[model samples]
Target: INRLSSALIRTSTKCINALDALRSLKDGLDQHPSITKEEKERLLNFISVARQEYDEIAKKEIQKAFVYSYEESAKVLFDNYLDNIEAYCNSTKLKDPITDEEVSPDEKLMRSIEEQIGVSENAKKSFREEILLRLSSYARKGRKFDYTSHERLREAVEKKLFADLKDVVKITTSTKTPDAEQLKRINGVSAKLISEYDYCPVCANELLKYVGSLLNR
Candidate 1:
């Protein structure tokens, strides 16, 4: 699902990393706690068009590639990541494009962007209070909050993403006796790598075979 995502989406031919980052940000806009409600809604509403276009263009392939194995855990990690983005955006200061700063990760004031996901002012107030309370509790326990704040959550997300990737790209276990359908699928995935991703036939099949071996183990 790496470059396949790029090819399927509009990330190819353009800077794939940039567009992928936007898509990721776009996905997290809902849970970011720093942006005001309005800003969040605005970005989501605006980005929805691009997301729709990507989806339409890659409808079939995406449907094939994007099944989640551990959906809930992955979702929780994603939400926390989005929250980090929001926190960063709300800092009222932008980092120098050339230099690294404290945030690697906005409350717009938190309301503007939070609104995009239907966070009301009342809910925002309550959420802010709750988060502060949680932070204090964590401090009391000598725990720092960050992306890896929840070890179990991180492990779950990693497993989920990896499993989904294997499902998408791992060829059958025994190519020697692959059934007709599997042979067809293997051919399709190989053709995809060769024609779309510019992998040579030999290299693509070799990669697929390596993947198949891992899955077999």
Candidate 2:
């Protein structure tokens, strides 16, 4: 009877230790920064399964020989749990948080066009080729415009490019020449674009001159 009692005591201790280890593992996983909410839930589910296994072992009829078997079973369960945790942690990829400040597709396209135009010796020549290429690509892709005519498509493209410019630069238009306030805004935008995008100053000036000519026409 003493031997049986001692065996029961050892088995109980082992079971308690296994449960504690499982709980500790779960707590660590819960606090991990890289572990996503879904991954954490997966880890918790495994821990719950380990707890169920331990509970079932504890409820069985106690014997001197059964104690060793229980201990061995508990060891195997906990070892497997640890191995799974290690694999999951190793396999899980941490992703950058999605931000609203990320550049939009339209902005990316505009930037590419701007870079192409700004890098050339003749801004007007570069702008004409870039615009033609874009229009040609759209035509080849069978893209339909609200207007039925090619002239309207060209007008729409110009409007879109300028509209996008307003988002990054403040440009208010009037029938007459730019007023003092308008010039100030234009200068502010020019400095900002040059600073932010490393745009060529001379090219930027030439581009603005072209835009002014278009608006006047």
In terms of lDDT, the best-performing candidate is: 1
Q: Name model 2 segments beyond 4 Å from true.
A: 1-16, 61-217
lDDT of 1 by residue, 87-153 (tens): 5435434443467564343344244434434557667655445555565678899987542454433
Which digits, one per residue and each the tens of the lDDT, describe model 2 over residues 1-217? Answer: 3333333365434322344466567656745799888988988899899987755442221111122223343344333322332333344332323753422223233333334224343453344354455545777889742221344333333333434343322233222467776666556545644665454565445434434444444
Q: Best by TM-score, which number?
A: 1
Query: Please, what is the TM-score per model?
Result: 0.27, 0.22
Count of backbone collisions in candidate 2: 0
Our model 2 lands, by Cα RMSD against the true structure, at 33.6
lDDT of 1: 0.51
- The clash count of every prediction, one per candidate, is 25, 0
